[model samples]
Target: MDFWEADELAAHRATARAWAEANIEPHWAEEQHRTGCHQTMELHARLARDGILAAGWPAEYGGSDVDPAFAQAIFDECAERDLHVDGWTTTSMVLHTIAHTGTEAQKHEYIPAALRGEILIALGYSEPDSGSDAAAAKTTAVRDGDTWVINGQKMFTSTAQVCSHIFVLTRTNPDVPKHKGLSLFLVPTSAPGYDLQPIHTLGGQVTNATFFTDVRVPGSALIGEPDGGWNVMRVALIYERGVSSPSRIEKTLAEDLASWAREARRPDGTTVLDDPLVAERIGRIAVDEEVGRLLGRWTNWQAAKGGIPGVEGSMRKLFFTEAEQRHFSDALDILGAEGLLAPEAPGAPAGGAFEHGFRAAVVTTVYGGTSEILRDIIAQRHLGLPRNRPGG
Candidate 1:
């Protein structure tokens, strides 16, 4: 796939980089101190207000009507600097899903405000029992005249505590097959019977276990048809699984390790990079980063051509996340005992970010879709293999 950078895209990337440095980077310290890697919507609002949040969307939706790659530029710049954009990304996924499946009234109520970053929405799909098998979700939303009463628990609701609403996948008609019986709802966090308990991961990010006990929302909260959540969820998952933006984490990590290795001297007066094994590990990381980058850009190219990635997206996610885990582990081995140090600790390599990243990388293979699941998709769709799962 040809991903040659055009002049316009290059210029847009420059502008996005400058904007991020001026506005977002300043809040990094304070935001980290306050939330420990959880974004509080301050930066998100600023991005929306400044028109960087949805630059690829139509003008009526507060965007510049440019190629999505323009927006992807901003996302990539932020990621390179270690900025958190999960809240923005997840909210945008929900927003786009709503724009496609929601009614005029629903659009009028939520879309504009969301495009302006007036609110944040979290995803409530996974449960204690249904991790990757999202259709198996047991969260129920029963119709009650003009309202829908929601009652169930959601696991790994990543940004639930900071979000104003949650786009929940609920079981609306259990008498039918699991996938056909599911429905979607936008539940306000202020409603009674909606609760969340923060779950801090080893990766230094905050997620939530959200509980819904008789929570009631208006009928207008339903997205798409009553029992058509699977279709709605498919749209959302496309965004999640697709390569919407570039991530330079492995590249950045390799650069940092290389810098450290260049100066690190052994007792024999040889630098760490001079060691054959260390050099070999760094080489492997660099190769993985480049391969992952090309895979992502290829998928992005497919999207630009109006194709929704199926096996291609799964392949990108699978390779990128798995490579990320390996890169972090390799970084730690290169740093030796110094890798064990936490952020701000004395003499910690890469200021302990790599150590934190190593912990965080463990979850990458599990979220979005597991490595095992992605393998299934690639096998069945790309290789024409027999369906392995029940519904497939």
Candidate 2:
């Protein structure tokens, strides 16, 4: 592992930092943290207009096609600034999958719009019945004359509320096995018979439950072969779980917690940062943050070298998310009763960021994949362990 940075990446980092400083409004962070409202289309248009949205994508698809390290730098910088780039990350992951596995027509139809941030897509993988057991999806799509009619429900769709399209996985052939019968479709959210309802969580963010009542799409909507969606989705999930780095929330929380620790005063006239135990906790968190950053950078490097991010992605996600949860849990302990104060309360530390973070951290362990499921993948796929039998 080379602990070195390339000159081009360094330049991109400088450019991204400058752009963010100038364009990322000061109020945007507070607004997003308080309301969980990310600048989706506006941010996309800005990034695209500035030629920074899909930096690693090929120039043919309206991307700069720069080094993959530049992509990592872009994400790192965004995280540093507390910018929510989940939508952009999701778009890039799907677009890259299409570029790799999609038909030329599919590429031509979706890539440009995706790069421009004009077309928003939501991931329709998790189901009400299948949370960690993503392969257990029961949504069905039956082929008709020139269209596929989909009927099922997807839960925990993060941006289904605003997204124009959904990349869904459905059982194309129920007679086949669980993973084999699956296929992926790019269904329009505005299509007739589709309904989306927001599921409010303790976390500030609003995920959705999307129901499809005979939603129909043309044959062209199919990303790959019929009943081969599992394969396509597997690739996409790998990219989803692996390629993207740690959540920016983690970094923002870390920085905020560090700042709070330095000055947070107890009723006993003792500042938290001065206490040895508190200092050690802060040190530990900082160390974990560094480790997460390094692991993410390595994953990016491997991808740039044409390597698949297999266990590395799982490792990063698992470690970073757990670290994030720990960071907030520590913050709550440090704040004691005051930590319970909501963001709206007066004199709340950093506007009750820790309180909000604690709630949001709960979903991190569940989303993408639960820690339990991720451990299973690491064991079965990465460690070559035997798959666990039921109740084993």
Candidate 3:
């Protein structure tokens, strides 16, 4: 299929741009740097009012499904304005997962709330030991009459402190293979025995370490069939990795660095752009950005065509994240000491944003899926390479 958008989708892009320019631009810096849960909730509420959040859900559910590109367009538009929606990314992932797999009652109850920025779901898949290997989750859930008792910890669960629900991946049948024995549940964050501790990261976002101590929930809380969460969780992963909610912030990030090179002075009173290596670094990042963008658009196209983006998802995540790290690091190198300044630091280049970006980019490699794991997946699935199991 052609990657180019039709006239209608292009109009959605214009609408997204107009909305971001009007509503998000004036507070762009604050919007980008706000780290509080309350701040994020308010941001999404504004996005919902602007009709930007959850555009893929049905209109009856307070969502607009007119265009598959609508959501990604929002990402791109906000990025241009330097608005940060880091929390929105995973929340959108969880929403999409629910859209695909939830029961009618679950859909009616949760989807509309999410559209209005009312509730958020924290993904409880990875543990201290099971980071990339989510299937090795040791979080146990045992059925007792009509309730399921859960006990264990989840690492890197973002927004759990603010979320009303924690969609947990638990082991319900240890007798079966690790993947086969898994189950999914939408455990309330206020459940009697649940706990959340904020873990501050270099990225400036606070993900959580959630603990479940005999947390009990009704059978209705189960997302899919018991011991059949491998499939359900896989769908969530696809959304996490494949869904490209455009944070086009990086697009201008690279462009701004290139623009700065002309004005930036070297120690000897020469323009930084005069350095061949500096020019080359910016050139390389520009190319990487283009490639990452095309790959994302291609994957988005595949999803719109009603196919699960398997290898293509891995491809986009791998290239885009690695490219992100490269962009930040290169910008830092080019900016030198000025790049190390904080956003509030006086005379800080790019308001020291690339320095902040450089630190955050380290985790991007590990988020969604690790670069190493994604490479292995692409090799096995796309390159038809022999799969090598770790610790097999």
Model number with the top lDDT: 1
List where candidate 2 sits over 4 angstroms from the true fold.
Answer: 4-14, 65-77, 246-255, 390-392
10 residues in a row with least lDDT, candidate 3: 31-40
Candidate 3: which stretches are off by over 4 Å?
3-18, 25-39, 60-62, 65-72, 248-250, 390-392
lDDT of each: 0.81, 0.78, 0.78
Which predicted model would earn the best TM-score? 1
- Compared with the true structure, the alpha-carbon lDDT of candidate 2 equals 0.78
**Cα TM-score per model:** 0.92, 0.91, 0.90
Question: Which pairs, if any, clash in model 3?
Answer: 75-246
Per-residue C-alpha lDDT of model 1 across residues 1-392, encoded as one tens digit per residue: 55554433575778778877777756574465347555647778777777766666666665655455566677677676667777776887787677777887887788777778887888999999998899999999999999999999999998787888999999999999888999999999999999999888777788999999999999999999999999999878877787534443234666778999999988899999999999889888888887887787777777657566767889989998899999988888888888899876888877678888898899989989999998988888899999896664
lDDT of 2 at 32: 67
TM-score, model 1 to reference: 0.92
Candidate 1 — which residues are off by over 4 angstroms? 3-8, 25-30, 65-70, 244-251, 390-392
Q: Is candidate 1 or candidate 2 better by lDDT?
A: 1
Cα deviation in Å at residue 52, candidate 2?
1.0
Error of 3 at 63 (Å): 3.2
